[model samples]
Target: MKLRIVHQTVYRYDRPVRNLVQSLRLTPSVFEGQRAHDWVIEVGGGIRGPGFRDGAGDWIEGWTVRGPTEEVTVAVTGRIETRDTAGVLRGHRELIHPLAYGRGTAATRADAALRELAASVTEAADSLDLAHRLSAAVSDAIAYAPGRTEFHTTAAEALAQGEGVCQDHAHALISVARLRGLPARYVSGYLQAAAAGEAHEAAHAWAEIHVDRLGWVGFDPANRCCPDERYVRLGSGLDASDAAPIRGIAAGQGAETLDVAVNVEDVERLQTQSQSQTQS
Candidate 1:
């Protein structure tokens, strides 16, 4: 299957920014079962009119503009070809290694609750059926709720509270997997539209656990299923902070207003016959 994606983020400040810098992870990743024909990060760099990536790879760019600049807009656009793998990640060449992910900062070590959860998820890795079963168990154990968490919340906090969005779901699953020594990475991406008549947000978060036999396979405890063609991977890292679509600092002081808009429209797209074979 092939997909075209465009994601945009805008910042509007009541006061003009003297300077700013940002790191972006907005480009869709070519991994595990995806390829990019043309992926570019188009930026309105305040004073600079436009900037873009010439090809596919980790990309970074920024700007320092004079004050009196009240708005900054960033957009990522590209055409990508993706397919569903046979529930396995193939090939030795990969950029999604665990050690390579994240803010490159030391993460606070996992606690006892997370350690126990990891044991539970890894205990049933004898077969695909067992893995799926474990995933379902997580789903049954947690509830999805918004506004129940903040940026500093931990897996145990969310689990004890029994509610969270995909971010919490990811932290819970990652904590469990990491405790078992399985290399898991946080995936930030946009899913194809949700089920018919469903009111859904435009983005989703999940985890990919690396197994001895099956390279890297995705598990979405929130939805109780493996990632299919509907999933378009953007970036992966140790946690959500590392793979956030945008992270930055603004020089302005007054309360700033920010708005983000994301649309990943692939309506009427059906899975391809060979989706089961393609794997990055």
Candidate 2:
């Protein structure tokens, strides 16, 4: 499947900021499951700086806006050809050891509840089955409720509340998986909605666990399935904040507000429509 994506983020400040600097991990991952084409990242009125691939094989680029300005916009446009790999990450080069992901983050730290949840899935046949069971446990533990949690909500908190969005689901799964001694990390990406009017966050997240021989495999407990061709993997980190597509800071202390819009379209569907129109 081929997909076209447009993601835009706008920042508005109550007062003008002195300057702004950003680190972007917005580029799509290069793996057997997906290939990117004509990808572009633009920052309005900003200068692009050095870029490098990190140990985790994620591309990071720096941008700066020498602003005494009140507004900044970051826009991304791209097309990707994707395959269904059954959520297995294949042919992706990375230097980080799987054990590194075992380290916990503030957002993914396991609490007693998480530990118990992880222990509840004790009857798996193998590590892969165990990982799947852990994800299912998390799915049953948390309900997907947007606006019920904030960015800083931890895995423990979300589990206790029993409701949150994709990020919370990913975090909670990561926490419990770690408790089960599985090396897990957070994955940030885009998901094409299942139906035209389906309620799903285009900007989505999931968890990946390392199996002994399989490397890393993704699991999205929020959706109760493995990621497929409809998903576009951008980057991974210990948790959401670390895996954020864009992380930036303004020099001045001006209050800031933000708005984000994301759209993912099936290029094949659009082309089919065009061909049908021509025949008509």
Which structure among the candidates has the greatest lDDT?
Answer: 2
Q: Residue by residue across 1-280, what tens digits does model 2's lDDT show?
A: 9999999999999889966999999999989999999999999999999999999999999999998999999999999999999999999999999999999989988788888888888879888999999899999999988899999999999999999989999999999888888899999999987424373546999999998778899999988999999899999999999999999988887898989999998899999999999999
**Cα lDDT of model 1 by residue, 95-178, tens digit:** 445434322222324666656554665456454545565556567667877778875676677777878777777777766665
Please list all clashing residue pairs in model 2, or write none if there are none: none
lDDT of 2 at 149: 98
Stretches of candidate 1 off by over 4 Å are 47-67, 95-109, 120-134, 195-199, 267-280
TM-score (all chains, Cα) for each model: 0.77, 0.97
Q: What is the lDDT of residue 200 in candidate 2?
A: 54
lDDT of 1: 0.64
Q: Model 1: clashing residue pairs? A: 32-280, 118-176
Poorly placed runs, candidate 2 (over 4 Å): 194-201, 277-280
